[model samples]
Target: MLESLTPFETVLVAGASRGVGREIARILQPNFTVKALLRSNIAVNELEVLGIQPIMGDAMIPEQLDLSGIDAVISTIGGLPGDIKRADDEGNRNLIDAARKAGVKKFVLVTSIGCGDSVVALPPRALEALGAVLEDKEKAEQHLIDSGLTYTIVRPGGLKSEPATGTGFLTEDPKISGSIHRADVADLVCKCLISDRANQKILSALDRNQMFSASEIVEFIP
Candidate 1:
């Protein structure tokens, strides 16, 4: 027998204007009503086509979020160049405070693999080029862990736009690395929202030699 932790309901998808965030909202539409938060009108048009309610809120400005009736939140927001910490760390704090005020609890944060190490996993040149975005992401992850909210952190390896591989893996340790299709990462995130088993776990998502259904993925929660 299967028991669900919470009813599938409205979700707020930060950064949903593009990439994994957008796809995640699309895939979850049938089962969950999504509020797609983005900073621009261009993104609003794309989400509106998919029947998503577009909310104009930059992760950098969390007070702008209208989180009423939001059952859960999935944030794929990232920062680059001179804006990583401002975007990820400060932005996340703002978002979390807003969610807390709204009485929303469940959260799934999309972060990167190898963000917390003394040395970033990516090549120094790549880090420099991105201006150390991972450092900001790492700080955001720690903030969530310390936020006293029910949370799950997903640290994924290189992100690609390929179709879901239909097979994926997770690790407690962050040493493993591989690329993952954006769709699979999205699916994993939605699954976490409804999974009681996933609470308070930090799981690394990667493409590996394993086959599992979305339900099976919940077992990876530690």
Candidate 2:
């Protein structure tokens, strides 16, 4: 059994302006002092309205990392559509290095399901579609795994904007696939910040009843 521990006092959220990162910050605000890393003034203003403390810095640049006094870091970093590929990886690696330097205890990284060994969990067509980004995410994951920090790597499926259906489950099962609501992913990421069950684990997040089982993809993917 994983040991229970005290909640972190300060948590830095990378990519907290949008998607799962944004929601994670919102969810974490009640329990922890939430600091979100952002790039633009507009993003800063937008996040500040929601009571999230915003730090202005692009994760793609290492020099901009002014982070300090952080006990844990939750990174939901990813490339935006039409942006350059692997940008998120570069940013995440920079954050990982910063966390290591700061001696942050827990680092939760949010990557997609088609990354690394999770590729087997996706259909061949989907895998092909995700080729470049997955490779970059793979590098980031390996770095975090070898970083010697207490870490949780969450690989959530196709993100949806709908409300949480509350069917989400975390499994080490690489055979699991399918989509999860972004809110559900945020909820899980927040829980992982304090859950001992998440330490050093690579978890796939999915709706229990919506899984893309291995049997369905075996003939096409394997």
TM-score (C-alpha, index-matched) for candidate 2: 0.90
Give lDDT per model, in order.
0.74, 0.81
Best candidate (score: lDDT):
2
| Candidate 1 per-residue C-alpha lDDT over 122-153 given as tens digits, one digit per residue, 9 for 90 to 100 | 56665566546776788888888887888888
What's the distance in Å from true for residue 165, model 1? 1.1
Model 1 spans with C-alpha error above 4 angstroms: 1-5, 82-86, 117-131, 209-222
Candidate 2 per-residue C-alpha lDDT over 97-200 given as tens digits, one digit per residue, 9 for 90 to 100: 98999889899999989887888888888877777788888889999999999999999988899888887767776677889999888987777778777798
User: How many clashing residue pairs appear in each of the predictions shown?
Assistant: 0, 0
Worst 10 residues of 1 by lDDT: 210-219
